[model samples]
Target chain A: MSVVPDSSTDASGVGADPRTGPAPGPSRAARLATRGIPLLVLLVLLASAPLFAAPFTANTLSRILIFALFAVSLDLLVGITGLPSLGHAAYFGVGAYTAGLVSIHWTSAAPVPVLLAAAVGALAAVATGWLAVRSGGVYFLMLTLAIGELVHQLAQSLSSVTGGSNGLFGIPSVRIGGEPLTLAGYVYWYVLAVAVLGFLGLWLVARSPFGATLRGIRDNEPRMRSLGYSPFRYKYLAFVVAGGFAGLAGGLFAALVRIVNPSDAGFTTSALILLAVVLGGAGTLWGPVLGAAVVVLVRDTFGPQLDGHGPLLLGVVFVVAVYVLPRGFAGLAGLVPGRRRSTGGTA
Target chain B: MAGWFDANLVSILNGFAIGSLLFILAVGLSIVFGMMDVLNLAHGAFFLVGSYLAVSFVAGVSWGGFLAALAVAALFGLLAGGVLSGMTEPLARRPILDQALLTLGISLIVAEVLSIIYGNNVRSVPGPPGLDGSVQVAGSTYPTYRLMLIAVGLLLALVVWLVVERTSIGALVRASVADREMVSAMGIDNRKVKFAVLGIGSMLAAVAGVLGAPVYGARPGLDKTILILALVVVVIGGLGSVRGALIGALVIGQVESLGRALLPELASFILFGTLALVLIIRPRGLFAGKVAHS
Candidate 1:
């Protein structure tokens, strides 16, 4: 909690001078003001989106919420923990499969499937992370990719359970108090409520001591180890937490689409989610949500017009973003308030 | 017993052919990452283009046009390498993730453009005319084209090994791989060596792509599949080791073929299983190479 403000100020590059304020307390309050105002306005806008948005736009926003939550979970590993997992969609897929299976076999009851999906996702993460976290850097990336591929293969081969290549369809609608969420507005509200809770939960974790320890691990694993902290343990716990949230997002996706396929677990999906996190300014939790919106909008707006060339537009967006907006939307936010002397510095 | 022997022999031959293709793909990736510290995910795009170009040449002209396709692909590789260098050198101080994302974007663009031009259907290319007939071996008839693949693989292995281990350029590359700053401090132009290696590596991938189209077909997303498989080969064989890639490719090729024969439903899992086991047993890979830890 204590480190969050300092890191934010460092990232912003505005509060570099120590003599900017009369006291430390005032500086902290100022930091919160600069960040919090934008967050509040964004929250209000997201919450009220269904009021004025069209049905298609509302549905797109709902899809964005699911992907945003997933991307944020990936950010926990990539940005905060310095573990860039390419197999993140494995857990997401597991959650989606669990939820889809539940709706098909056991019940259409919403909470039960979501909770079960979370549990399955966390367990899968632990199982995979145990071996994966043992290696660092490129090896870690490779291991995660292999594990993700294995899961994808499983999804395809387990035909009876997963419905094979065609995927599990006709998943019952998520019901709230015996009422199905049929309309786009209703689905949006439901997804928004879930997303809010999910975001707040993750925000609390990010602002906690655990989050600070993760940042420390990311910056210097050896130093953390020298200070008597087990880096492996922290990484494992973080992976589990990230996987849990990814699973929740997966459940939302399954409900949103009413189907789950092996493609959901594919490496391309994982890459896109990672791209979203990077585009959003990795460490900032909320930035990924905005990143997801940009990616989804890019895909949606040009996808039909370009047909098969949609990924080409996205590729252009990625390359341009890397060169032009290196710090992503969060960095852009810092520039808007003119806190930093120059926006050219590395984030 | 004779029947079993014939089947096993054929499987082994097929695996080597597949493995030979993988070696060409993986070596480029391994060398680029090992020497330059850049994981060029776009390496796959080079291969994708080669495959598509080969398909076009073979269909429009003749099988003899395969060589022309390879030449064009190599030229394209050089141009692409120059473009990549231009894009990446400006951001030389950026993190590996940023560089990787940039390369990935290039790859995605290539793949999409190819799909747009070729229209996403899987297209196969026939081998050159002379390599069409089947050869009888161990009581089984096998495509002579596959044997030619093995021969190509062996020749490439020998050529690469001789060049890397026996040539002046190879020594420079080795020295650069061991200590880049030290090599540069000695007044050696390491940047040129890096570019040369990148260009050569990309060319190798293109050649593999031309050869691979006959067996695997040219298709959208072929880049992603081949990229993952090649990465796995590099990891299992140990990064930057030419010999390791050869051995690793052979092993994966066998696993893929045998798994397809035995457990068709679990062919991909067999490869993943090997990867997991190898990583657990030797995190640096089965044959640790000159590449440094990240």
Candidate 2:
């Protein structure tokens, strides 16, 4: 609650200083900002997709980019906040359904539905977060899971609105500023911009004072309480914020696909996000983006071709990550001679 | 008035029948969770495995072979538990995130392997010959197999209660769960205890699956559904507590069965409603059981 940013309080012991803030000499924030330049450059490359990659490849890239936004939001909770939520798909579904419903009935500009989607996502988070923040440790994990499952069940059952087991189809393309954004190349550019902005925003949040407080709560809740900070408040804020981003991503997805299905809220979506976080290294800003790309690519390459072996391969990869690279893909930095040390195992 | 009482009693019995089976399955889940910290997301896989294996076992043999099938299912649980232990052992050192991910991966693998072996189709195991018939109960002709299922569920629940509450191995397991380091310090290798407990837990799940197949039916996605229900049971029953498991099972089972019978449309929603209400009141679980650590 204090406005003064306490630079010294790494007291919440979850991980090292992920927040690149007002430190001495050139400021770590500036350095991180500079480091982010390459990511932007990559984003630029992604945006000009049809020029470099094939249309199908470009569409794949767009899908990955959209998922990357979702994954990055997940990383806020899973990696940075040290709350490895297994059921974030609740928010994702909320956002998608919001947009889906909006698009189905009333013809509106894309931004309206997107905003509504984010709003629904935030609302869902607030509702669920109120209950979810009570329990810490494993119990917290289970509670979030239940909430996510509950939402999924609701969405599946409310067929009149959600279209039930059979999802809404033939949804018109997103009408943006009185123009239809139907081109895949245009969508890819939009997705890339959104993902880049999402990452940047989260990265900034991770460096902010609120981020430091979350770290404290994650590492040692009792100690945080001793320091006069309520862990529940901090957790609730972070949960809602994370949910908001998930909604943002979900809205973007609904617009692009023009449909929202039950899978949007299922365990598989949760698993996918979890895998991405674990792969990219949960707390790192760029980790989920990288992990999402890898997961999407692997599935795109192998899943359809492998016929019944896709899940087996993915499962094997997941097991290998758990045992071998607990820190995720970004965890490889630890193995390098002079690279940054990790906060914990990749998972 | 008599007819109304009879109708309500029938619904309640039907609910109890379902609840008892859930108790059987969830008891194993509760015990394993209580004794060992492993979530065993793959626990439901063992149940599915039990159902399929029972189908194979029944195809060749007579009623005497049911005992053999049950034993085989138990043995499978033991082997599966061993594999699960091996996979989750490293992450088991740390809490929470590791256990969750490792078990989740194991579950995925089990599901994939099952699909590879059995294909993505619903398959049924025929009830034992004599029990295949229906019996008149409370003016409703319930399947004889369902009645046997209730009997088997209760019988297994009793045996589990006896072994866990009264047996030496149960005591050792409980003690280890209380303090693993202390138990190990006392020269009672907690690993052995964990392995044994996991084995029994898995056996319980398998037996539940076998018995449940004729009553609840079998499908490709049964593992996933069973896993979610078992989790609900664990949360309701309290982590690692046998008594908690029984209550949780009965409550969830009744909700599921009655929901199916009465509210045909909202059957799935009913199970979740009970879970949500319980979770709101008691986040640690309605019954925390005897384990010191969550």
Candidate 3:
């Protein structure tokens, strides 16, 4: 359970579980993150003109951070919960469209829209996950894909409410007290805050008895059931949690973009989220954020140029990541200490 | 009233005609997936190649030359089957997702490479002269080409069913899917068995591509659509059962065709609605399935 347990190797040089370890003290993840300081420092140097990287680049980075949170949501499901959702775009789109629609009609109380987006995402997740988590691997994947597409098709057909194919646009942005926030600043802060809180929250979840039970379900659902634990309940709980987190990411997205296109809920979007999780290493807390960064850079830079050929690249990455570096970027540290624990089990 | 009846009845005929091709495309997918747990995403790529080959052949020679194009496409499929077999045999032992991801990669590469060479445009393969005209059925005029397509498709389906149900090879596939390692231990060259299974499956997909291209038209995203449809067929029919595939295909075909004719607005939801309900009720599939989800 929980990928060989978090007790084996601690970067902090203190044997501590990532979940229960004291928060105020030097954390184990922070200890692990420090191992990549040299790499981060070098990359920071290359990106020296943080101010001059153009509002465009900064805006793009902001979007990537949001996507990273999206991927983290997926990681919550796939990496931790042991459910590889092919329809994560459902929650993401739900959150995005909710924020867009609410702000368009009401345009009041910035927190309300964000709260509503997460609620909508979680509600949809509860509905879809009830059915989805019941199935095993492949069907679970296909059903999710079908559910995601079903929502997308509905969005297309119900244009009157959904704004149809054109999507909701020209929506108002979030304001703290009647002053508009800087586009990059607002996006950066929101993404940063979500990523941090999300990381800590999930870390806590992974440590709690419930998290341990989820890991048990992931590793051996039948055995856990035999032990008198209803694995289905555990799976349903994880699925709902993942959906809420995914919804949170989607809300931030609507706030940033001010538009919710059909593509937001499309299969391509789901596939991209999968790619980010695979790149970031699924179970690790901060891995998806880093992955979202890589994917964002790739899309912002190469996505336009590739067009139809973009699937080719994403497909290749999916295969290669599964084959070559299954552990993804975060697990790169674990590899050094001969720690082969690569983010949860694959079923 | 009679005139209106005739008008709409012809639409059902057209729907059945279109559905025949869908069945052809989905059949091979159902068999291979049913027998071997491999989800060949590249099946549609084979179809695309077949279509492109047929278009070229039809452009240069007589419409009968389309057969020659099919033969070439089949050969290409065999080569692809063998190569993938050699590369992924070890990997397929684990989970279906790994195989899905691998095939997804291969197909992406095939699509990208082929697009670069052939370019992305809708291309057609002309029908043979004898089968290219109009025909009257039930006091309604239907395109002769479509009527002929329906007949030819039925014949292909019959031939496929006969081979799978009445051959030693079919037995081997049925046995292999139940447990490959057991079949391997039984001293049957399971590799040879699988090689043949994939070759036939791939050829089946390719032939459907060559024949259906003229009707549906070939494009960049055609393969993806075909893949999804095939999966739907397999799931409905139950995975690994040929009869299930056919039943599923026919159900979907009838759904799309009749749904469009009767209720155009809700047409998109018809098949999906069926799928959801069917799955909830009959989680195993239409036909009694040999393998259960792991």
Candidate 4:
């Protein structure tokens, strides 16, 4: 009779199930070769990307990387923690606006605005998360939607500060060691570095004991409560952490784009990010990055080609992806016959 | 005080008119969610479809044409709802998120198609000829159409209340909402009930779209705007309760219309602020029904 889906049977194997006990351990060297090699290769390729790519290509890649960070942060909530937030853009926009303002009125140092944005994003989460975390499931989704719309309204009405509908303009390029990185290649390098670092931080957290507790709660909240864990505190902390990273991504986005607008924190952005997480595979950390790339390429890179029917195309993607790829693109790993069992451990 | 009342009377009446319109849009959404755990994100798209139908059918704003438009919109909603029900059927055992995404996708496609046909212009329908004029009320002149809208909304509300509260069909719906398993155990086909509810609910949204065309107009992004408003109303009133939808719509209507007149800068904030405050104080909403089960 329970309407809630069975989380344990989820093919994507996002978070480790408490009931299944710990997964069998891979040998240390074996784990390194399996996980480390591809990551190393990817890093090398991305680092060398700006060397050969055009300026526009570098910029688009930077956007993909920024959104990858954003999508990963949201994955921490929707995929790992099992909280379906529809208003995550609130924190992202807050971070972007904060970074933009910091760059405009204060120093444009790369880390200063980015770090401050993360802090502000976490603070915003604290302000809104306490009330939101009180409810779970669809109610949580509605509350977040309201909070998101509230922030969007604030951005629209606080004309003097947010520049109203026109958004915050005149944002200077990010500076490194007292030199502005004005070129797209240099900006992409900076974005790559920050995104890599942010992704690593989230990756570590997802593998931590805290992350296990979140997965446990997601699977069965009442059981978690019975085991003397306060689901509220854990969810609130996860929300703040996710918000901080989303803000970091937003900060990098503002640095890359050099502007902050209301649409950055609007519902459409939130929906798109959520779609990215779902499309990529909810529980897998890296899957959403792939999803974000597809989303950005489709909406921005190729959307104009079909007479601006990008949304139409995206709509079709959503429908098809839901039915065809339930566990998302990451879940595709589980589809390969013999790889099914192994994908449960690594996917 | 008298001057303030005189100045704001129109806004108050406008609130009632808007509330009625919102009730028509939201009651179906609420009930459908309550009965079937499907939050049809495309509810707004259905409404837009109705509005666009009005734009086409009510060409000269004649009374007969308007009635025909309403009838057509209702039939279209029923057919669309049936399709949506079938589309979402396979995902019934999945997470609400899946259903949400599926409906959102449907809505996007519908909106895109409509925009393609309508050219994204803000096309508005005029009221049927007799109701197109204005009349003096208190110290201000009010649109005759709005008064009619208010009366029609109340009449519809009354009819809906009678059907839900007094009829055997309403008992089945209420029973299903209260306990889906028990209803099925009692030899009822839950899927059939869900289909009927979704169809009726969508029809309400479509009919409201046609009814509200003169006030809100048919526009490209209007679906999203109306969807958000309806979500707010549904949240405030409590999900799945007819009385709650009415009360929530009325409350939101005042908060929106009166808030704008009283504090333009914080008008939108007031609406969401009320939502936040309500969630904080009473997370289940003003008149939470028994149907909300996570």
Candidate 5:
């Protein structure tokens, strides 16, 4: 019944597989031109976006950045750690709710709510991750899904706290040093700053030694175990960190949208983020971010114009992407000029 | 004790009624996963299709009309299942998640198409004229349709059990579940078996949808709700086991009804709490079949 080949073989071949392996050495100038220059250019464009773009366009871009962070956080578990979670929005929703409640009842101070959201998100992950990490593969997916649904139910039933299906509304705009960031451009800048930090944190974790250990576990748990690494501990930590980042994204989301609803933490949100991760390429950090942008554009921007048939288009994308873009947009990196084609096909 | 029984008797019966409906829906999911290694996420969409068909063809109609609706829904489900099976066949060599996502996509499209046709309003199907009225049961008034539902569910369960446990074709299905390679080695076309299982499983889901229409009503999100419930039933009962599906569905049914009656505040969490508890104790479920090789 098992379709997966032996883990040993998979681990041995990982280095040769272009999708999972590090690129062969390139000169510093070439690397600078290929990676650094494009990243810098993109950052500059994003920084200047609100200056030139319309208010509506700026607002939509903020949403994309928030979800891009959310998707990248998911990539930590799914792409790097080899754990495909379907309920990640649980933490994201928890973070959003925390931010909303804090902003409403305590302080609208921007950093305070966002920080608390991240902390609470980590706590929620620790609470659920212990049980979820016990199982692997599809079972893990199902367990996380159940956990997500439970959170959604809690959000719905705990009306006094979460405001129930009506959602928690009337949240004040986030304040910076006692002044509210009311304008769309100001809010966009705030969101972009936080999102970039969250992305960098996740990117660092993915490149760190700990991240490599996670990749080891994903490729072959038994080998890692024999090498004296506790797979569970590493996996649990990754899940917590990812949850924290997801929460950070959620906090950003609440600040931008000023409303937190049950659907924010529901299965649909979780599934959409998962689809983004897959569509962008699971393990590629930047790929999922791109996927998130596409997904957000399709559902939020183009959806209204399509007579609310955005989901139909999304569904078609899910099917078509799985079949045609198995490696996602990240897999097309080799097609660029002056880039060497990666050895081997799909992993 | 008698007073309490009188007060909660309706809830208990409601449990059975819902349990029977769940069994019909989940058995197909359980067995298909076991035999074909495919998790048909579109199972709920199939159920939704049936409920809508019930709304269109069975509501306010005669008994013959309701029966004809069931036949039509079943046939439609079979065809849908066949197409799904074919779509998923090529992805067999890939990860199971691919198949899951594909089915999810199909379900999304189906749901979108359905909502477009039926609108977002909640549409309830009424029982046939003869079965629509209330009848006395143990000194309490109850809907006659529910009692009939219980009887029908029990009869269907028996038929399924007998077919799976006592018949030759059932043996083939069991064998296929245990070891597809060995069954294929014996010259059986595993693909045909898979196709049949998918078709039959889908048919069962649609039939349950029609049966559950009066109780659940046809709505936009009903498909997702039913799908989640069926998934829970399958998980608790042990995937791919008909007997497991029966026990799991009944257990969840009672939990759902009794929880709502007893602790309305925690009603939603009760079912998932049970699932978590089960996972902690026996992650493979209560009646897990032989552990398939990973």
Candidate 6:
């Protein structure tokens, strides 16, 4: 019923799929060192990216990181918990709009708006989750899709707050230490720092015992229920956490792009995030980061040249990915020798 | 009070027109999902294709052009459905997510390609020549095209009922929906049945697309919007039953148009609230079909 055993062991202590447990015949320290090396190299590369890349490239990379964060959060529900939410972008939009509103009306203290956005996202999840968690499988998928469209329609219709279809513009950049972050390079770093922190926090949650129970529920909800674990409670919690994280990503997105349109909360964005997660391999924590990078870079590179054909190219990518790389980028990456088990649970 | 009565009458007529469109579009989706277990996200793309084809084939106010478009769209739908079914055959036993993603990929491709060809603009095709002008009904002037749509919708619903409930092919489809393995055990050639079900479903969607062109128009975002509405109808009506789809579509259609007219601010709220209520009260839908799978 599942694609692969959600190999969850990770150096960062990200939760591994409980069904598979830890890999045999390998020292934990050995696993840590092997995984840590690549992660360290990647982080260092990201930290120094602006020094080498063009300003536009740096800015684009920042946007990629934001999307990557969104995808990673979604992976928690879809990959680890087996919830196929088609409307995950609702929370992302909630965060973006919240941050945008704050920036427009009051403060641009960077962290404050993002934190508020996360809180708002969590609250929205709680409200929606109350009803959404009642069903499973296809029903859940449809419900999420409905809620997403509802939010999108609201965003479009509520022109005063969302600026309707035109979206809210002129969002001020983050100001740190009472100084405005005017430089393009500083903005990139600010986004990177927040995204990295967001990802790390998710990693910690996935590593916890709570994450393990969620995996158990995904594998067999009935079995878990018999064992006296409330799958509903766990699923609800996962939904809220994922929503909060997605909101953080959205706030960062608004800050990075300086705009939040109704489309940000639409099904298209939700589908794109799902595509990235599936492309990266749902179960792996870091795979979606790679997936986000690929999707964003492909669109950025081809969007201008192709004009209207960008979506066509993306469609082609989705079809090819499904047939050729069902296990996704993380699955392909796993084929490389000497890698430790990574975080991610199967559906 | 008389003005309010006229408004109510108009809303009711409008509801029927929208409901019938929903019925035609969603019935196919319901059957395919129930019998084939393949949730073709690309179903909406077929609707878009039908609309676009109608625009090209339709000469101003000509029934011949509309018929031609319908025939071509059905042929296209059959070919597309068959190809997709073949591709999806291997993944039948795989996870639903994999299947959904694959189909979603197909939808994305079709939608993008269409946009590229047609551009991202709303293009309309006029209704048949006979139904071009307004007709007076109950002291209110209404579009003749809309009334025609209502008539055709009711006729199609009747035809669908007769075909599904009274025909031999219907028997096979019902049996297959009940138990695929059992039908195959009875030597019914489940593969052919499956293909037929998918093909017919696709054809129905395209037909509705052609018929609905005048009312909804053809556009870039139409696919997603129609897909969502169809999904809502299917969910509300029940998964596998034909009667369920009819009732579900009509209710949603009425609620959407009437609700929008009655309370603009709370229109979406009321519409979505209905879905939420259905999920809470009867997760299987108002007319829960027999094809209930875990």
Estimate TM-scores for all models.
0.92, 0.91, 0.86, 0.94, 0.93, 0.95
Candidate 6: segments with Cα more than 4 A from true spot: A1-15, A335-347, B1-3
List model 3 lDDT by residue over A71-143, tens digit each.
8778877766667776799898988888888877886355777778888998988887876777656667667
Off by over 4 Å in 3: A1-52, A163-168, A305-308, A335-347, B1-8, B52-65, B114-133
Candidate 4 chain B weakest ten by summed lDDT? B285-294
DockQ of each: 0.49, 0.47, 0.33, 0.50, 0.47, 0.56
Query: What ordering of candidates by TM-score runs from best to worst?
Result: 6, 4, 5, 1, 2, 3
Worst 10 residues of 6 chain B by lDDT: B285-294
Clashes of each: 0, 12, 5, 0, 1, 5
Looking at model 3, the pairs that clash are A159-A164, B34-B240, B133-B144, B134-B144, B237-B244
Q: Across residues A53-134, which tens digit of lDDT does each residue of candidate 2 receive?
A: 8778878887887788889888878766677787899899899888888877887475777778888999989977876666
Candidate 3's docking class is acceptable
**Global lDDT for candidate 3?**
0.71
Q: List candidate 4 segments past 4 Å from native.
A: A1-14, A335-347, B58-60
Task: Please identify which of the two predictions, 2 or 4, would achieve the higher DockQ against the true structure.
Answer: 4
Q: Which has the higher lDDT value, candidate number 1 or candidate number 4?
A: 4
Please state every model's RMSD to the true fold in angstroms.
Answer: 3.8, 3.6, 4.7, 4.7, 4.8, 3.5
Candidate 2 TM-score versus the reference: 0.91
Interface RMSD of 1: 5.9
Task: Point out the worst 10-residue segment of candidate 3 chain A by lDDT.
Answer: A336-345
User: Which candidate has the top score in DockQ?
Assistant: 6
Q: Looking at candidate 2, what is the lDDT of residue A176?
A: 65
lDDT string for model 6 (A282-307, tens) is: 76777888898888888789877998
lDDT of 6 by residue, B28-120 (tens): 998888787788888898999999988889734688898899899989888888888888887776677777778788888888888878888
